[model samples]
Target: MTVRTGDELPPLRIPITRTLIVAGALASRDYQDVHHDAEAAKEKGSPDIFMNILTTNGLVGRYITDHFGPRARLRKVAIRLGAPNYPGDEMVLTGQVTAVAEGTVEVAVTGRNGIGHHVTGKVTAELPTDGPGTGDAPGTGDAPGTGDAPGTGDGPGTGDARKRTTDSPATTDAPMTTPDTPR
Candidate 1:
């Protein structure tokens, strides 16, 4: 069954890509060519640039919460970006149930490109049960099923943090950093 707000989820996965990287950076106003310019990327010590960690975490949340429709309210999301993602590398976003409480479900999350992971984190979101309910979330000021988030979510919780996927590449011909191929 689809987990509602505050309901722990089994797990989820997402693929990263050049398009995702570009779309994320553009949407977030992070106009760093290092994220879009292959030349600038190489100059900055990278291979074809990558998606900022902020969008990575945001997308991860999207992957899980979207599965449950509008009823899911994002509570908290945290992450760390690891390796750079090139055009060909496939990134896998995955997470498992961590906890559920007071209309909120927490999930530990992680995302790894073929070279290595680019985001590892946690997220909390409101999940409504199938029974009769107030449809109001503890921190969602507007109400449940609404895009508006309140209290903890309305403040410093709206946006995700971002960082270069890696200080160096992690693959053969990475053109910047050392390869971190799985052991």
Candidate 2:
């Protein structure tokens, strides 16, 4: 994972279904009516049940981790919501690497839907400095199927959240920022 400033991550498209909105709200223990009950949302002056911040946050984290590999740890995620995600729409998440340090990377992210920008934020994450394919190296203790790991994943989401599709090319770019060097 040689990351550099201006490197663009592959876009991930998430369908904003009613099931997803409700399930995410339920899974996150957010019982807000606006996130699940369409009638309640309508009563609150909304056109339909909308996605909650927690659900969007999880999706954002998933987007970054999916692109950076599961070994990546998100240090900070600062985001603001713009458009309300309705049941029939989809959100496309895109990111650009903004900074790269010794073992850290920062990405500027945007999630756009039919109504416009659904979410926008910056994510700071830590990556293994040993480079790509080192996530399963000896002593990492994060090897797949280790312990009660629930076995290997069949791609991104399974059992929770909507199944998202990724349209990514072989997207990683060469490292322009050197380790411990100022950007």
Candidate 3:
């Protein structure tokens, strides 16, 4: 079950509650109390506040991985925060593929609140393909499919993307940098 282009993920609607906020924070190792306490969040600079970006993103990743199955390798992920997710607010995560290349499938992901967008996310996965989906055949699923995974060498995503594996799996886009920030 290597995911192919246009592979759709299941819908998720989770209410952003204090417990969730705390759990997300703890799961991501982000100990910022602002995410766990309303008053602390307010003192920091929030009206009602909720989980931090890292926490929100971790949940989103978990959601995708769980849906895509064990063969899924998260190759890329990008997200931007907008409206704050406060307690009692429902956050929905949805996505669809934008492109595929050499074992990689890219998807445009977004997180929205009841009223509007709270965050946007991008992710790519080197998923198991149609044949057995487990890549169970050695030289294929046994490895991360740097293209040599089993018989998928000639599979659908064989392109420049194969070269990207040498540096890192590129789980996220380039970090945002500005001229004003010191290099």
Model number with the top TM-score: 2
- Number of backbone-clashing residue pairs for each candidate, in the order shown: 13, 1, 12
After TM-score superposition, the amount by which residue 44's alpha carbon in candidate 1 deviates from its true location, in angstroms, is: 1.3
Candidate 1: residue 107 Cα off by (Å): 0.4
95-117: candidate 2 lDDT, tens digit per residue = 99987765677899999999999
**Model 3 per-residue lDDT tens digits across residues 126-146:** 655444334323444335555
> Can you write out model 1's per-residue Cα lDDT over 111-155, one digit (the tens) per residue?
777787777887766555444322332433334444334444433
For candidate 1, give the lDDT: 0.58
TM-score of each: 0.64, 0.75, 0.66
Report the lDDT of model 2 for residue 2. 55
Candidate 3 regions with alpha-carbon error over 4 angstroms: 1-7, 130-183
Candidate 2's displacement at residue 167, Å, is 31
Global CA lDDT computed for model 2: 0.76
